[model samples]
Target: MIAILKTGGKQYIVKAGDVLKVEKIEGEPGALVKLDTVLMVSDGSNVQVGAPTVQGAFVEAEIIEQTRGEKVIAFKRRPRHDFKKKIGHRQHLTKIKIKDIKVS
Candidate 1:
């Protein structure tokens, strides 16, 4: 079975045993997090979609690790004015492994 869930203002499609990186969650490694915003679910043969979210539907995940993504450089230049600026950023992220999805 697979489920589409929302967390940290983003949506993700996931299944049991899948590991994914999402916006950083506040917790230690091995922490168990329950995501209640399940948008849709499918059991191979049948599918259920929610108006906003499916009531009583949830996905359980375990925090695997916390990491940061590759740095992104932002550069700005004004050709004739001789003005230049450069900045870099790395986004913090959390890796979680989907343990189970319960649908009611």
Candidate 2:
């Protein structure tokens, strides 16, 4: 089965045993996190979509690690004025392994 869950203000489509990186969440490695904001669930032929979110539907996951993404550089320059600016950023992220999707 597969499920669409919301976390860190973003939605992800996931299935059991899938490992995904998401915006950082509170949890240590190996911690169990239950995500209840399940928007949709599909079991091969049958699909269930929620009105915002499905009631009594949840996705269980195990936190694998806390990490950061690659740095992104933003640079600006003006040749005549000799003005230059540069900025770099890395997003905090969490890696989680989906254990199960339960719908009642």
Candidate 3:
């Protein structure tokens, strides 16, 4: 089975046992997280697409770890003014493994 879910302001297409890195979620390692904003569910030749969301549908996952993404560098410069600025950042992320998708 496959499911499309929304979390942390983003959407993802996933299936059971798939590992994913998503925006930082509030949970500890080994914790169970329930993503309830389900948009679609599918089983091979059968598919169910919801209008915004599927009622009584949810996906379960296990938090693997909290991590940081690779650093991103932003640089800006002016033609002749010698005005240069550089900034670096890393996005916080969480690793999780999809456990189940339940559609009622």
Candidate 4:
């Protein structure tokens, strides 16, 4: 079975035993997090979609780790002006392992 869930203002499609990185969540490694915003679910042959979210449908996941993505560099330059600027950024992320999905 697979499910599409929302967390931290983002949506992700996940299945059991799948590990994915999402926006930072408040938890440590091995923490159990229940995702209640289930948008859709499929069970091999049948699919169910919600108007906004499926009631009583949830997905369980375990926090694997909290990390940061690769740094992105932003550079600006002007010809014959000697003006230049450089910046770098990295986004915080949390890795979670999907354990199960319950549909009701």
* Model 4's TM-score against the true structure: 0.90
List model 4 lDDT by residue over 11-34, tens digit each. Answer: 999999999999998998999999
| Cα shift from native, residue 94, model 2 (Å) | 0.3
Those runs of model 3 whose alpha carbons end farther than 4 Å from true positions after fitting are none
Q: Score every model by TM-score.
A: 0.94, 0.92, 0.95, 0.90
TM-score winner between candidates 1 and 4: 1
TM-score order of candidates, top first:
3, 1, 2, 4
Instruction: Report the lDDT tens digits of candidate 3 across residue range 1-104.
Output: 99999988989999999999999999999999999999999999888888989899999999999999999999999999989999999999999999999987
- Candidate 1 C-alpha lDDT tens digits along 1-104: 99999998999999999999999989999999999999999999999999999888999999999999999999999999999999999999999999999997
Return the TM-score for candidate 1, rounded to 2 decimals.
Answer: 0.94
lDDT of 4 at 6: 94
Q: Model 1 residue 78 lDDT?
A: 94
TM-score (C-alpha) between model 3 and the true structure: 0.95
Error of 2 at 63 (Å): 0.5
For residues 1-104, could you state the per-residue lDDT of candidate 2 as single tens digits?
99999999999999999999999989999999999999999999999999999999999999999999999999999999989999999999999999999999
> Which ranges in model 4 have alpha carbons more than 4 Å from their true place?
none
